[model samples]
Target: MKRILLLCALVPFTFMTSAQNSRPNIIYILADDLGYGDVSALNKNSQIPTLHMDQLAREGMVFTDAHSSSAVCSPTRYGILTGRYNWRTRLQSGVLWSYDPPLIPESRTTVASLLKQSGYHTACIGKWHLGLGWQQGENGKVDFNKPILGGPTAIGFDYFYGITASLDIPPYFYIKNDRITATVIDSIKGATGKGFWRAGPIGNDFKHEEVLPQLTQKATDYIKEQAAGKQPFFLYYALPSPHTPILPAKEYSGRTHTNAYGDFVLMTDDMVGKVLQAVKEAGIENNTIIIFTSDNGCSPSADFKELKAAGHYPSYIFRGEKADIYEGGHHIPFIVKWPGKVKAGTTTATTICLTDFMATAAALTHRALKDNEGEDSYDLLPLLLQKGVYQRTYTIHHSIDGNFSIRNKNWKLEFAYGSGGWSAPREKAARTQQLPPVQLFDLAKDIAEKNNIAGKNQEIVKQLTHQMEIIINDGRSTPGAKQSNDVPVNYLKYR
Candidate 1:
């Protein structure tokens, strides 16, 4: 009887060990300001040919109604990392600046931290706009030579090599594992036209055009190094390109017919190809899971007029661009390539938020998330494998300005009128005209969000509004113990 019991115990233990060893390496590739229509596979009319991105889409599961948590860079990044709404934090509107203090609190658990606890070698190699703790010098100047605290390393990532903010925002320098790679002794002047970057302090060796390539090389090198090891790795490769400074390398410049921005998109696609090639070269392609998504929609810096003239629509069939409350603002490309796990050449219209990444990782690693962690995240493992419908009750959307919108099934309700961001009939203009107090759209019938039926559907507006209030007050969308928001948030006040 003792021998039989020992055999039974060892059977389960063997299975558990095998499961741990089979955990796939995860690589999350985040594209900066790349829109849904930017990828050729998603949008047939896109002038910029994103072959590599298309290939990834074809080989993996593509989510059609995926969105960034917020309509802009910093907030979306915050939601992606923390699995909580950015509006709940002190920053209710706009993006964080280059030298802003760390936004993520020390106590907060990030996706990296969760995975790190699961024995994964985690690294964040790219734009970390969520903020960093820069050591201040005399007269409140940022000390670049010192090690910055409360950054990727401080949070959860074992290693970090990236820029602090957008490519355009400066203190233009590279940070490798919390330390500046070089001393910033000079100030670079701003440039106009396509390659636009704010004039600010820059490292002596930093170059605008070299940012994307350098980061790509670093990511590829990291992948190669990790592949040689037995431990499964997690890499958050946040891309800086197709966003600003539109500085494609000499070889990539003029590669597209849609001018500088399109050329930059092509370069971004090539970088994606390089990363994919790196995984394959390392002989870990089959065991690796690559998730390619954008931080948010395309910015107006891409020159909508010029792109339209060249027969390219960055927002695709959506109504507005990046910072608006419309679908285009947050609706982004979400593709996952998990070889032998997720079905290939499959697509789903399941609406998912970038915030879901945390919970998904937790599920993959067999870790049960605590109530305080991944507050807004829903496990997407089922959706990835197409096992069943992972129905989301609702998704809250935030704009560049402090406007709010809620989506429940096919119905959407915007709390404020106008674009609620940077678009025609802006908040001031719409208010001057005394537009409706709110807007409602049936997205299934009208994906463009053109016809608002708020006056007709009073019950839906009330229900959605009530749901939003509940979600806000509860401090989370997912089921858990009641939590508290960092600050006060009243979405209705925007009206």
Candidate 2:
């Protein structure tokens, strides 16, 4: 009887261990403001060398039609973690700035929280631009002495280390698990030109040039520590590089010879290599799923003229740069590596959004999400495994200025008269010039989005417009029970 009881206990323990071991470690590397053509593997004519990212592309699947949910960082990040559109929240346009209240509600489920419930340890390192519950003093300044609230830790991450917002944003400091690493007793002057930063409060140790290297070291340390344990971990390494303050390390500066931005990109890729090395050294390479992507397309801060002069187009053949309603703004490079699961060197043209991460994780863990969770996320597992197809037919796109666009395969309909963002013939100018109220493009024939065919294809435009309204009114792009947006979304405001 004693032997039988011991065997039964051992059986359950063994089964549990087996289940845990079966789950793969997930590492999502989100590069800020990286463009499709930045990676040489994705863009053959690129002048910058992204060897590490290229290696990932060679060993895994590359998503050619992948896009951020929005043309900017904050919104895309919100969609990425929540699996819901960012516009559903009150932030209809632009990104969250420093000291902004946490965009995610305390009750909401995030990708990190969802995986944490599924027995995975989660950590978010790098930029937390989604927002934070910053306490303010009577003087209306942020209280640096108190612990922060409603941040990565509050949502789902077991551990969190990053900045309040972008590197260029003020109150420059490091945050570890809801606490500021250093007190902000000093200030720094803002700079312009190549490496620009806003004037604001800065911590003693928060040097903009050293931030990337510090983040990389922290990520590698976390990977090493997690690899020693049995529980699988998910690391969201949000890199703040090649964005602004294009301060490539001394060793990396001038290495690209193309420009400061190009040199910074090379540094970013090298940091990725270091992270990959950490995984390999930890012996978790085979059982780890590494996803490399960008929050959005390249920014104009990269100096498009300089890149073009060097015979490199950051957006490749896409029309506009970041923040535009065109393909160049949101379309990004997405590379996934899962040994033995995803075929090596494979490419998929299936359209997918960053929000899909939530559902994909659910599918990987064989868990069904509630209707209220992951409302806009569609499963990319089928596409990843190359055995099935994506259920998403039409994906909605958002511009920095809150303009809405809908893509149905090769056809795209933009509810904007002009670039909708920081491109030429801005909304005001276009309206003043009496431009059309809407723009449409057949991507198959005009991948650059140079021509507007809205009047020529009224039926297709009508169909897409109706679909966009339904997606917004239904509160989700994916099929589920009718959900509710955190706020009212009016896509017709620009129209």
Candidate 3:
């Protein structure tokens, strides 16, 4: 009621009130493998500094208990764009590779496509690990000569620029539309060594060292191009930063407690600054919904050993880091700056997931969402706008191995016996300390998830289990009365 009343009061006072369909420009800035501790605004224990990102949080709203859809990359990206859980897809386990099939099916409605249908220009300008099927060559290599198939363009972005997968993956060339920004002339080893990336396909101008600069330039250029047009644009600015092989610009190297990882994160902050500047320079800062977040928690390999040796909690108070089913793997920093709409210097404890983006976009644009559209995504505009405590009802967590952990009304249940993805690779026997086959934590009481309370509360456990079953079987969570929007899409239909 408070939120609704607040919106009612705010709507007339602010120019941001929706017209029949005067949609706002949207910019989603995603950080690769960043943790809750990566940003100073979220964690003050002291690591790398993020000026631009911190500013973003200050100007908008910072969701302290925010989470990524999954603990790893490909799956989380699947959930982010589709607003549905990735596990629902055939990718029941691991992530996608550089040359894999499209993560999103043709029928599924992505934020880009949904907004595009509403007359908003959309573009994805960063890492696209969701996979773009590549054509093979005459000599039996990835025929870099072939146009990338089933990519962002096919997914609804009027303009697309990004990598088919992770930067560490071979065939490290950038893609503009369906063609490689750098052509393949030499054979480069694939990420897992399965395929050789035909190099030289990229221009002599392209180099791994120039990736951040390259993507930044392209994004700024795209913004500039969009500025001239009157179209309300949505830019999915997923940055390729703070991820492995930590390569920061020459000036950003050697600037943090951890190592190259922190350095690269700092560089990513500068990239955010550039984007924010573009929004301001375009004079659309207030109307643009600029959100900064991470795909998932920081990777354990990202200087974790060094940080542990130094007694620094990279994942902060969270038990596991990255791939673990623990909070650290999925808990991430989320900041939204909607100028006139969202309140400044405010924070929310709402347990929201990245999957809610689809619904949020649809709601703000006055479009409806079918129950199956992004079944997992509940509209969070109310929360972001600081209208009131619009509870998420529940948020589900998926581990790298398909293990599931669910959080609803403060009680979280993990279906796995132990730390699902954080196995101590070196010590097989040392893994016994993990939770039993099923562990439960009252996050409202034990935010650290240090104790398992499943045995203590049988009724609660059964109820949550029943709820989880319903969510899985029905293909949508049973919580709030779902709002009618775009017709639901069965992702499995075209798969």
Candidates in order, TM-scores: namely 0.96, 0.97, 0.87
TM-score of 3: 0.87
Model 1 residue 445 CA deviation (Å) reads 0.9
Q: Judged by lDDT against the true structure, how good is candidate 2?
A: 0.92
lDDT of 3: 0.77
User: Between 1 and 2, whose lDDT is larger?
Assistant: 2
Best by TM-score: 2
lDDT of 3 by residue, 52-138 (tens): 889988899999888987888999988889888887787776688756888787788888889999888899998898878788887
Question: In candidate 1, which residue ranges exceed 4 Å CA deviation?
Answer: 1-21, 388-391
Off by over 4 Å in 2: 1-17, 138-140
Error of 2 at 190 (Å): 0.6
Error of 1 at 281 (Å): 0.6
Candidate 1 lDDT, 1-495, residue by residue in tens: 999999999998899757655788999999999989999999999999999999999999999999898999999999999899999999898999988889998789999999899889999999999888889888687788878999999889999999989999988889999898875468999988778889998888799888899999999999999999878899999999899988877887777888788999999999999999999999988889999999888889999999999999999999888998899899999999999999999998988999999999998988998999989999898888867667578999999888999998899999777988888778889999999879999999999999999999999999998999999999999998999999998897676
Model-by-model lDDT, in order? Answer: 0.91, 0.92, 0.77
lDDT of 2 by residue, 1-495 (tens): 999999999998999877876799999999999999999999999999899999999999999999999999999999999999999999999999987889999799999999999889999999889888888888997788678999999999999989888889988989999888985469999989878999998888789888999999999999999999989999999999778988888888888778899999999999999999999999999899999999999999999999888888999999888999999999999999999999999999888999999999999888899999999999998999977878989888999999999999999999998988988878999999999999999999999998999989999988888899999999888888999888888998986
| RMSD versus native structure for model 2 | 1.9
